[model samples]
Target: MSEFAFEVALCALLERERDEIIARQLGASVHGRRIMDIVCVEPGPDFAKRVAITPHEIPDAAIESRAGVGQARYYRNCFDMHPDRARSVAERAIEIGFFERVRQGSRLYVRQTARYPDEWFGKLVGIENKPDLAVPGDLELQLRKDVSLGVFDEVILATESYVTGAHLNRIPDEVGVWRFRPETGGLEVVREPTALDPAASGVDIVDEYAGRTDMRVATAAEKARLRRRMAERAYGKGWRSFDLPPCVHGAAKTVSGADGIPYCEWKESVVNPAEECGPACPGYEPADPPEIDIEAVRDRRTPWVANPKGPRTQSGLDRFL
Candidate 1:
């Protein structure tokens, strides 16, 4: 399979526990409304026909007049709903990137929140009525019409590593990628940089479980992660969720298995190692060995000839000189 071009981002999961916290307070689910396998399709042209995942809305009361899963949790942990809670779940949500806390004039402010940012976060393109905001939380989340959950759609691969190894070919302009998290959870945004960039932010998780991006590396590191992930697959247990190296062989150093035989060893000797390859391979980034000397090379009248014993000139008497 070839790499499919698609924009990518993330939407935080809503508290969708299937139980009630208090008899009076309850919680809501991000995917609560639809029981089907729904792939949230975004309204295009950047605006219009945007849909909201209605389940994120704050319900009037628990399903049975008690705090449902969401209501109880938020209230118990100090949700804005119950100003008398022991802790504030809303504050924690903002701290953990669940929602944003913006100031509204006076005490009456609008909520710019979403259960899953992708579920209900977007431009108000085609929304007919203003949804009621009853979920009492520090940050009030609102609904939108133009945008949708970011899945395999808004991703970008800066590094060619994914393209080189996989049978997948990524078509251009497929997914919209973002370098930073969105303010309103408008699109799916991850904390980690795409594997195409050498930046090492662990937040580089896939937009979803099935989605994946490369772990950007300096060839050797990439090889390492590839081997680790591949080992899981070779064992017939783990699914191949991450990207692999390119078509080049021998460029990767295959670690030996306990069987006394190496898997995929031929790929290394057959492929060319990149210049940035590390100790696992011959290539490496230039690191100053030591502040030995500009004067050492300049002062020496003759280059120290290489001897198996040590680096020195051939002349026995000249050694001191």
Candidate 2:
């Protein structure tokens, strides 16, 4: 099976096996984003753990470096692109301590006190997936980097390859190893990973560049900000957060198959629902169902707040429940 298929199947199994878990999201070595195949987040009340799902305009360096202080207009304009979210975020900024009300004057000025809560998420686990360890590409270096980064509480490598002493020797000792079974959606722990001290160890924000680059240690505050940002993203957009392709029947109904993957009765196969589906697909049929709801919800923080102009929406809490 293709890696994408394996990833999809694994996610399907994880969604069920780890239902209590708050969120899961896919990641890659993307710019400014955390590096991990799959990020599993465990929610908590800590200021650092909580993340606002509302798509508020992030303050630029000029505003953020100003010691969390900014004018009401500053925030308003920041959210100008997303006018619908402006009021909620403006109010939420104060409610969540991101901003402090200076005065509700003619301009309604406010100061940015905090960008994100100090502790909202409790534990974060980074998982690296490799169906065939024998064809590993820079696996050792990647695992080593993760161990040194110490951003996640634990780093685990999940693979469908057979476990052997030789394979274990090639992997980092600090990294956890999991033997995955795609057929049964089973995972067996071959090695347990050790927790790292974030403050003491420090994390590497950027990966090695030009084969030889300086590794800067990230401060606790920097790490906190990154964690908050990632958690907010995870909460707002789960790995399964994708628009389903409309079928000839109006809506493409999705279900988990015996192999722990999305099964489409229309396609009579394990369909990749993450991608677009329509007339382009081989299984296209035009039999629209009556009373079908066609909508897409991007933000899931405040469902009560109506967005008649936009697609349907719901709260992340509601999704979790």
Q: Measured by C-alpha RMSD in angstroms, how accurate is candidate 1?
A: 26.9
Error of model 1, residue 38, in angstroms = 21
- What does candidate 2's lDDT look like per residue over 195-267, in tens digits? 8665543646355567674466766666555555655556544554444434553343333331223344665
Cand. 1 Cα-lDDT: 0.21
In order of listing, the candidates' clash counts read 59, 16
* Residue ranges of candidate 2 with Cα displaced over 4 Å: 19-34, 46-117, 201-214, 246-268, 273-321
In model 1, what is the error at residue 318, expressed in angstroms?
79
TM-score of 1: 0.16
Which model scores highest in TM-score? 2
lDDT scores for all predictions? 0.21, 0.55
Top candidate by lDDT:
2
lDDT (10s digit) by residue, model 1, range 1-321: 011111111111110111100010011112211111112222222111011211111221211122222322323322234553222444443343333444444331122233322121111111111111222421111111001211112222221121221212222233222222212323232122221221221222212223543221123343223222222121111111112222222222211110111112333222222222235643333332222232232113112111212112224323223
